[model samples]
Target chain A: MTETEQRAGTRPIRVLIGKPGLDGHDRGAKIVARALRDAGMEVIYTGLHQTPEEIVEAALQEDVDVVGLSILSGAHLTLVPAVIDLLQAQNMGDVVVVVGGIIPEEDAEELKKLGVKAVFGPGTETDEIVRFTRASVGRA
Target chain B: MSLGQEILRGDRRALARALTLVESDPHAADDIIAEVYPHTGHGIVVGVTGAPGVGKSTLVDRLAGQFLARGRKVGILAVDPSSPFTGGALLGDRVRMEGRGSDVFMRSLATRGHLGGLARATPRAIQLLQAFGKDLILLETVGAGQSEVDIMGFADTTIVVVVPGLGDDVQAFKAGILEIGDIFVVNKSDRPGADQTMRELRQMLHLGPQRTWLPPVLSAQAQQEIGVAEIADAILRHSEVRLTDPEQRQRRMQEAERLVRDALADQLVRGVVSRSQADGRWNEVLAEVAERRLDPAGAARALHLEQD
Candidate 1:
């Protein structure tokens, strides 16, 4: 482990997990949250029905290492871009932002180009999420 | 000036500064973490999740106190709900944890409409705390809804809190809360139906396949502080069990990978679109799509294909 990992051995990786827009299907989001927690990262999950502004503001206030967005309503194009824009407008381009839930491969590429660090579709192994986040946050 | 560096050096003041930067300037926070990337990964992250009205805040308060008493510096990241109308946070967790604020490093973050019971800046804040020499970090989510359960992904040990008298076995199971718990906590144990809840949880646990690690369901009265010590112990125990399992570690790494990939995609896609929009390409394409001159897929393809 690196020095950061050594230090983090005593502290947890903090992440802000959110579900943006009106997507009511949160089962996958919740499962991922639990999986991340089980893997030793601190998670702050924003409840459902959040606007883009609220998501950005929460990210600002929480000071999280990573931001995970879960959406299953096929609104990834509109909502995801809006969130990325809000974060960038707020000068938060570096906080790792990821999205999950029912995203198609095509949309995933679009989201990736929009500065989403990662996109996990359904059946994404929980362990994959933990690994990517740990690495992204430099814990790995 | 780099919060990540300051955190690595265990500077409390610097850690605070870093958290502030993360909360306001996430881009800057990223630079900070990049600088200090080599010095993280040594903390125990605990997540406390449960249904609403289960006194989760109170339980967190007591648990933090316990860690403080043990001489471990604690970092508490409490995720609060945002106001629907104002887009601001009510942030009630801070008020609930008023007394412990001075002792432990405590910060309450409003979810601010981020779904899944998570706040956006929470990860950066935890890094700051780790850099500040906090040995243990406690992340208390809003409540045990599906969104709240999703937030559990951030914890090394997850304690799913429930209350007695909520409902019968069917109701409890219907909530689907059973599947997410690593350690089941029946808070409000002093209530009349506490034992019944505990028994039901235990029965459910046994009915499941015999895994290497079987989650334990314990009772607690967060208001009275009853079983708080046991709850803490259970969390620690779960952590130990998790640590020993190589499969668990692998699973965690994989999950982290998914999170990172998804985040990267989100960031990159947004960047490309924004840059294109700034150059008037986005609007032009949208207009073309709207006028039936080009298909949406074709427009998207042209936009990205041109970049490559």
Candidate 2:
């Protein structure tokens, strides 16, 4: 086992990076998935155009610690909170939901109000995302 | 109450956390397991293994759905090999079970580059799920490999899924998988040569060693959900019969013993192997062994795993 694994009660932190919209863009999600993986977290990436229900269902099935929603198609407000509502409905309120991609400042604050943990808008560094994720979920 | 107590009380988050802990630090998870083991042994552990593309996932999904329809809870632990370069995995097995509601708790675990965890943590995962009140747990292996037989240790019933027309008669009856399968299933049975494949399997079972269970050969067209209930019944039958069988207990105990022994040995030598790699001693030793210039056993003994 690695040193981190040697720690009692520590498992590899699991993150689900998903895109929940009709927008076919997925580069942001894939990039963030790679970053999380490089940071030694287990990442499950859902490819383009996933329904909020499918995404939330996957989160429950995978038992992910955090979910990163990638939305570039101006649907963050509707799609992001819809995922949050579904997660909450399934008693998965503890799962930290994050967002990345193009979003207006107003929408990012609205997402925060909707219980998104953190948001990475345009020109954010991958390392920043990794660090924030590690800090948010803590070790494992 | 302890985490184990929470798990026994059917706390979903606690169960998920336990699986995560087991995947990363199995040695540590042993402590929690010791606390909760008495609450276990109720649920049936089913092992599903086969070569890739054998429809193991699809069959398992449908099988789990059947259990759900009966108001029984099911858990699935899907194992996939981690990428050597990235140490990350794309666990796509959950895709098949995506819409299947919350009654089924499924998680995908990377093999983490060890043949041992498939044998070790798999049982522990099943135990945790069992304690969480699951009626059945399906453990799907990482395709199939020589070590995949280790799944038999944890499962009360092991279903080896095979598809027709993969190859000729000789290729189909490779002794490695044939020997360990508790139940041989010819999946995609609606296709051509399905009966012929079943016939070959029966012949192989006849030629192979006889055991307490004759290892029933069955068929399933998983896509259409045909013959699933019979397979489910077969699983239940095997699990029920094996409960009181001392031989089954002995086999499981022996498997547990080997896993502990191997895990300790691996931990002991892992640092030494890393040091050898860093110091350029690994390849040199391998080359010497390959050339017969150095006795592999002697070389292993000479380089102490722990430098005293």
Candidate 3:
């Protein structure tokens, strides 16, 4: 078990799970969202087909602890950086940003350089994600 | 140290807790801000925005690691989209950073349905981080659309990331993302067509008259960690230049003034509406408006008159 699991008690981390763009495959996104929720964090799953504006607006109002994006349409190249830029423009540079699904290793590195905290690829265990989140938020 | 004092002294843990309180119960925001306000304005804020799939998150992760290597304490705000189905957020940004969460300085926020591409609690969150003594703060939003551009008003510097084969030029033009980018990054440089995309971007940038700050176009293979250092250097340079610009300071102050006024107006309107509802006056006004006995504007005017 990770240190986070050992330290996990209460104080669930709140995460905002989003699906941006016209991507229609939401099965993975929803499953991950549920997994995060079951892991004890408050998960807000923004339904499929969200515009960038809608996603940002939701992040602001919900006051989420993190922004998790799941995109499978290969739009990560266009969408992920845009989200990061928008947050920075809004003076929200302190929020942890991560992405999951179908991201290539090369693209993942690009995103990290752009200021994303982490990127999860296919077959990553939901528990590992939960543990990472707990550790990131310092709850562990 | 007391929580308030710790926050003022730039304690990361304290800042995180304070932010949690503000989000869960905004009634405490004023108190927390009052305590930490004096310690802010010492950090550089960088905004990274672009359309979906532009590899923004990986860039951020790499940049944070770069800054960490430089011994600078960093704070990141990764904004996620709100769930339309449930009005909540899934908050998954921390997954990328993995073990870095041990740093005790990073946080994430969901949009929670706030408009203009900014998390409503984002400013407060940044202030909390600033108070925590973070030398640099980065905000990564969900996408680079128009609302994202509007939110750029809050940052000291804004970096826009675009990837090759994404038709970024056309999208940037359409979304006005190009206008707001202080620096443009062509991520995924190893991909075919990256050179053409960069060349086209350079030409597009040069098409306009040169401004005081020339936006540089840099290429990065983020997955390979190539050019990450150059990107960080560019951000620092821009921040340094912005700090020295009097006009930039003036613009920030102006923006702050507008935000303050807007917040006050929203609060006042909300207060009056809620109070009227408790006093049964809101229902009466609504009835009148619904029955066409009085226009909604007229009813609102009457409420304002009563307050006066």
Per-candidate Cα lDDT values, in order, are: 0.73, 0.79, 0.75
Top-lDDT candidate index: 2
TM-score of 1: 0.64
lDDT of 2 by residue, A83-140 (tens): 9999998899999999999988988899999899999987899999888887888763
Place model 1 in a CAPRI quality band: incorrect
In the predicted model 2, the residue pairs found to clash are: none
1 versus 2: better DockQ goes to: 2
Of the candidates numbered 1 and 2, which has the greater TM-score value? 2
lDDT tens digits, residue span B157-270, model 3 = 788888888755565554367778888899988888889888888888887667888899999977678999998899889888887887877887887897688679867876
lDDT of 2 by residue, B149-244 (tens): 777667778898988898775585676778878898999998889999999899889887777778899999887899898898888788767876
Worst 10 residues of 3 chain B by lDDT: B95-104
TM-score of chain A considered alone, across all candidate predictions: 0.90, 0.93, 0.88
The better-scoring model by TM-score among 1 and 3 is: 3
Please list the residue runs of candidate 1 whose C-alpha ends up more than 4 Å from where it truly belongs after superposition. Answer: A1-140, B286-302
Q: Where does model 2 exceed 4 Å of error?
A: A1-11, A19-40, A45-61, A70-75, A85-94, A100-109, A117-140, B116-120, B145-147, B244-246, B252-308
> Alpha carbon lDDT of residue A62, candidate 3?
45
> Of the candidates shown, which would achieve the greatest DockQ relative to the real structure?
2
Q: State the TM-score for model 3.
A: 0.69
